[model samples]
Target chain A: MTSQDLFAEISIQAEDFSLADEVALLEKDNLTDGAVVTFTGRVRNNNNGNSVTSLTLEHYPGMTEKSLAKIINQAKEQWQIGRVKVIHRIGELHIGEQIVFVGVTSKHRQDAFAANEFIMDYLKVKAPFWKKEQITEAGKTSENWLDAKTGDTDKAELWS
Target chain B: MIKIVFFAALREQLDCAELSLSADDVKTVNEVKQRLSDRNSQWRQTFSNASLLSAVNHDMVAGDHLVKSGDEVAFFPPVTGG
Candidate 1:
C-alpha cells in the first residue's frame, strides 16, 4: 500500500455506492493485504413489523465525517488494518436500498473482521446519524425517527 | 458567542437546527440546556428528556462539560445508525 492508502477515507453522500467497487479500491495494489472484509447495511421493507415505505437518514454535517474518522482511527489503534473505507448514504432511501458500506483490509482475516465490526459498532452510536422510517398502513402514511437501541450502546461499550 | 445545534428528532421536536448564544450566559452544556428549558414549556420538555445527548466541538460530552466562547455545542437524541 502507498502512503495515500495509509489513512482511512470517509464519505457522506446521498448517492449509493457499489460494494464491489469499494472493496476493490481497498484491496487494489495492496500486496500486503491478506484479507478484506466488507459490510453493507440495507434498508428493510419492514422494521419492527411495520411496513416501512422508506427511510430518511439524517446526519450532522461537519461532525458526521469527523466521527467516522474517529472510529476508523480507533480501529487502527487496536488492529493492524491496512486500508479502511466507509461510505454512508443520507437523504431519502426506499426499502431494500443500500444505506451504509464499511470495508477494511488487513494482513490477516481476524484483524480485518474485527476492524470491520468495530467500525460499524461505533458508527451506530458514536456517529451523529439518525434514521427516520416512513410507514404506510391501510393507505395512511406516517413517519417516526428510530431511536438508538440500548443494545447498540452496550455493544459499543464492550469495545472499550 | 457559542454556537448550538440540534440534530434529527431533537431538531424536529425543538423546531430548530442551530442558534447562537453569548458565552457569558452559559458556561457548560448543562447550563445551555437549563437556559433553553427556560424558554418555554416545549423547550423544557424537550431538553429535559433523559435520553437527550450532547456534544461540544463534535466530541460527545456530558452535561457538565465546560464550554466557552467560540465553542460549538450540539444536542440531539441518541444516534440510530449502522
Candidate 2:
C-alpha cells in the first residue's frame, strides 16, 4: 500500500494539543479488545541544570512530514496496530506545554505499549525538529539548545 | 546543472538551502559534494560530517550512487522523527 493509507492520523502543528481527542481517535477502529496506550511528551522549563523560560522549535517544512510518515509506516509493519496518532508541535512554546503525543491501539496491551514506545524512540532520533531553549537567569542571559538526544538514537537502535 | 539542497541544521549552518553546480564532470552525489567542497571550507566541513545523509531525486541514497543533470540532491543530518 501507499504511504497515505498508513498515515491516516498524523499531525504536525504549532498550536496546543489535546491528548484526550488523540487517544479517542486512536481507539476508533473495530475488532479491538479495547486496549490503548499513549505517551505524552511535554516541554520542561529546564535543560542541563539551566532554567529555561521557553523553547523555540524549528523544522524542515516538507521533509519533516515525510520523515514522520516513514516512521509511522515502520511501526505498522512491526506490530498488529489498529490505529496510531502522532502529534508534534513546532514554534515557540512554554514550560509544561505539550510537545508531542503518541497513541497506539491494539488488541492487547503488549502491542499498544510496544507501539507507543517504538514511536517515541523513533521520533526522538529521526524527527527533523530542532529546539532552542531560552534561558532566564538571575544575572546573565544565555540561550542553549542541543540536537536530538544521542540516547534516543541508542533507543531506536535497539528496536532495529 | 545539478540542484543540491540542504535542510535542518545543515541549512542553518550553511546559510542557504539550495545551490546550483555545473553538472559537467559531475556524475554522482560524491562528485557533486566534491565540487561543493572545493568552493569553500564550510562546505567541506558540512560534507565531512559523518552523520550527514544524502538523497538523490528525493530518495535517500549513498554518496557514491550515480546521478545526472537536473537531479535534486539533498543533504541533512540523520533523521530524528517519530
Candidate 3:
C-alpha cells in the first residue's frame, strides 16, 4: 500500500531521524497535498533550570505500537489527512536529542492542524511512555523519573 | 477468584498492584473496593476518599458492575497517561 494510505508508527534504535526525510515520505507519491504540518518534541538539556544530562524512555512493547496506530487511525478518520508519520524513541538518549516526531499532511490547513494536534494529544496521554531525566549539577548526576502529568489528560480531552 | 491490579500513581499509593480474593468475597466491584479498604489504614486512605477508577478485563467499568473469576480488575486514579 502507498505510505499515505496507511499510518506509520515506529520505535527505532537509530540515531534520531531527518525531518526532511519524514516530510518527504508524506508527499512521496502523486500530488494532492496543499498543507503539511509537523510537530517535533525534542529532549532539551534543562528542565525548570536543571541541567539534564540524559533521558530514558520506556514503553510497553507490542501494546505501545498498537495504541499509537489506533490513535492515528482515529485522527485519520476525523480529518482528511493524506499521510501521518509518528516516530518515538525508546531506551536512553542524551540532552539536545530528538525524542519524538509527528508529521501530518492534508489538502487543507484545517485538516493538517487538526490531525497534528490530535496525534500529539493522543501520544501524550495514551501511548504508554515514561521518561526519566538525568540531571547534572556541579559535576554530580541525579536521575528523576516523573509520571505523566494531569495537564496532558486535560489537553487530550479537548478533542474527545 | 479475581485478581485486581493497580498501576502508576494508584499502585504507588496502595504500595501494591495485584490482590487475590475469593469469588465469594467480592461479587460486585464496589464490594471489592470495600474489602480492599478494610485490609489496613493504608488501603483505606488510598481508596475510601478518592476518585478511584476501575477496569474489568482492561476496559473501564463502573463501581457496581459484577466481576467474574479470571477477570483482570484494575484500579487507578483517573487515568493520566497518554
Candidate 4:
C-alpha cells in the first residue's frame, strides 16, 4: 500500500474504535512528523435542557464516506500534514459513548492543530450524518432530532 | 426514472425512504421537489423547508442542479455530527 493509503483512513461503523489503535496506525513508525493532534467527540448526558438517554446517528451510507473523503482531501490541500484518520460511529450510542475521532500528524504543531480543527468544523456542517436523541423529560421518554447548530456553521465559515 | 431517496429526520417525517420519478417530467432538483411537494400539504411543507439539502448522484448539489435518467437524488436535513 502507498503512504496515503496506509496513513489515511475514513470509516463509518456501528462498532466502537480504540484511540490508541488509531493513533498507532496514523503514525506507523514513519517518524517524519514532529507533532500529532487528535480529537474525540463523545455523547453528552444533557442537551437542550433534557437529559439525553442515548443518541442515534444516521447517514446516507455511500455518500457519508465520500463526503468525509472530500473533507480530508480539502485538509490535505490546505495543510502539510502526514497521516489523517477519521472515524464516525452510527446507530445507537448511550451517554458518555465515543462518537467520533479525528487524528492528524504534521511536521509542526501549527499545521497539525489547524488541520485537526478544520476537519472537525467542516465535518459538522458538511458530512451527511444526522443525530437523534432519546431524551427524558418530566419522567417521560421521547425522541427528538438534533438540529445543526448555527454556531457550528459560523465556525466553519470562519475557515473559508 | 431518477431514483430519489431521503435520509435521517426527513425520511422519518415523510415516512419515505426511497422512490422514483420519470426524468422526462423534471429538469432540476428543484423541479423534482416541486413535483413531490404538489402531492399534498404535508409534502409541500416539507419541501418548502429552506434548510432542506439535496444531492444528485451522491454528491451534494444545489436546487438548480440538473438531473438525468438513472441518477440517484437524495434529500436530507443539514448535518449535525462531528
Best by DockQ: 4
TM-score list, all predictions: 0.97, 0.85, 0.71, 0.97
Q: Sort the candidates on TM-score, descending order.
A: 4, 1, 2, 3
Evaluate residue A114 in candidate 3 and report its C-alpha lDDT on the 0 to 100 scale. Answer: 91
User: Pairs clashing in candidate 3?
Assistant: A124-B82, A125-B81, A125-B82, A126-B82, A127-B82
Q: Model 3, A1-160: lDDT tens per residue?
A: 7635754556544368888988887777737778889988888878778998888776544546776788888987899888778888877888777878888888899999999988889888776566777889999989876645778888899997
Candidates in descending lDDT order: 4, 1, 2, 3
> What CA RMSD would you report for each candidate?
1.3, 3.3, 4.0, 1.3
- Each candidate's chain B TM-score? 0.97, 0.92, 0.90, 0.97
Q: Write the per-residue lDDT of candidate 2 for residues A84-121, one digit (tens) a residue.
A: 78888888888998988888777788977898898888
Candidate 1 — which pairs collide? none
Off by over 4 Å in 1: A1-5
The fnat scores of all predictions, in order, read 0.79, 0.42, 0.17, 0.81
Provide the TM-score of the second chain in candidate 3.
0.90
**Roughly what TM-score does model 4 have, to 2 decimal places?**
0.97
**lDDT, candidates in the order shown:** 0.90, 0.77, 0.75, 0.91
Instruction: Give per-residue lDDT, candidate 1, residue A12.
Output: 94
lDDT of 1 at A32: 87
Model 4, residue pairs in steric clash: none
- Please give the range of 10 consecutive residues that has the lowest summed lDDT in model 2 chain B: B73-82
Ranking by DockQ: 4, 1, 2, 3
